[model samples]
Target: MREANHFNERRTAQAAAFLLHRSGGQLPLIKLMKLLYLAERKSLELYGVPITGDKLVSMPNGPVLSKTYDHMNGAAMSEPGGWDSWISDRAEHMVALLDPSMIRTPEQDLLQLSDSDLEMLQSVWIDFGHWDRWQLVKYTHDKLPEWEDPQGSSQAITYEKLFQVFGFGKEQTDALIERISAQAYLAKV
Candidate 1:
């Protein structure tokens, strides 16, 4: 019984971290509850917990599971209560059994980018600022240049030039480049 309680607490903490991470460090009660439900489900599968649907009831002020799940289909709009507050409250309640470090942070590292790479990034950003995922992908396929190895290329572009052109701090630009590289989205100049 003690072990079960401890597991539940850790699961709850992990759920909180997943929710906070996905929501960019904040989430409404509804969204958080839904994430918690999914996290708990994953935990059960992995840990062989005897927890059932009924055992996953929400706190009095928290969202009910059904309503919480339903909210996932709704449009992305701000909930009445602040997202930060809800996450903080739940996090505090579960802190005793939860590890705060379990939460994942957003990617913040920079990847190497050539001058051509920076140009492609800027162009894509400009062209698809308002585009959805499919539209962006389609546009990239139709219009973007193919990436090539910079090793043998004679392109004179440097990080300093990219910084000057993009008007982003060196660190910020590098992080963006790194993210693009990770996604295999960097374009060669």
Candidate 2:
């Protein structure tokens, strides 16, 4: 299985904020994580890119956006920059938007998203947003090939493995990988 690029915290934070805004400033933590995963997965399928660039991990529950999950649960050692400026409380298995004013519009938080990205996110929301946490979990476990019984251990889901599951042509996978690699490189420079 081919590894994907490293997690991008800034992008993850942006995605979190966008979801919070979309949900009207509050979402159950598990539901938020599931939505993020579904949106990223959809983005990958449609555009060969994930919305947040976060690492994807396979857990017993399903596939999760690892770094973003950590942020949502306050597990990260240091919160991603700008995270505290907007997302305020993570309590009772829920994450709440601290400041609605922090973002003038969802577009502001979603600067990285292209028109296609927005469309995919919308599609994901339309399809999955109403499902409660458990329903989302069932859908993911049933649908995503990346999911495996981690047996209580988190397993990394590499893009290389995912490409095989998605049945994408080699050339398409190569182009996606190349673009992702370039973006990762550029983020560091």
TM-scores for all candidates? 0.27, 0.89
Clashing pairs in 1: 110-174, 111-178, 116-189
Q: Which lDDT values do the candidates have, in the order given?
A: 0.33, 0.78
lDDT, candidate 1, 1-189, per-residue tens: 001111122223333444354434554444344334433333333332211121333232321233223323232232433122123433422312123343333222111222332333334334433344344334323432221223442222232332334355767655544543443322222
User: How big is the positional error of residue 32 in model 1, measured in Å on the Cα after superposition?
Assistant: 0.7
Which ranges of candidate 2 are over 4 A from the true structure?
78-81
**Superposed model 1: Cα runs more than 4 Å off:** 1-7, 45-47, 50-54, 58-87, 90-189
For model 1, the local distance difference test gives: 0.33
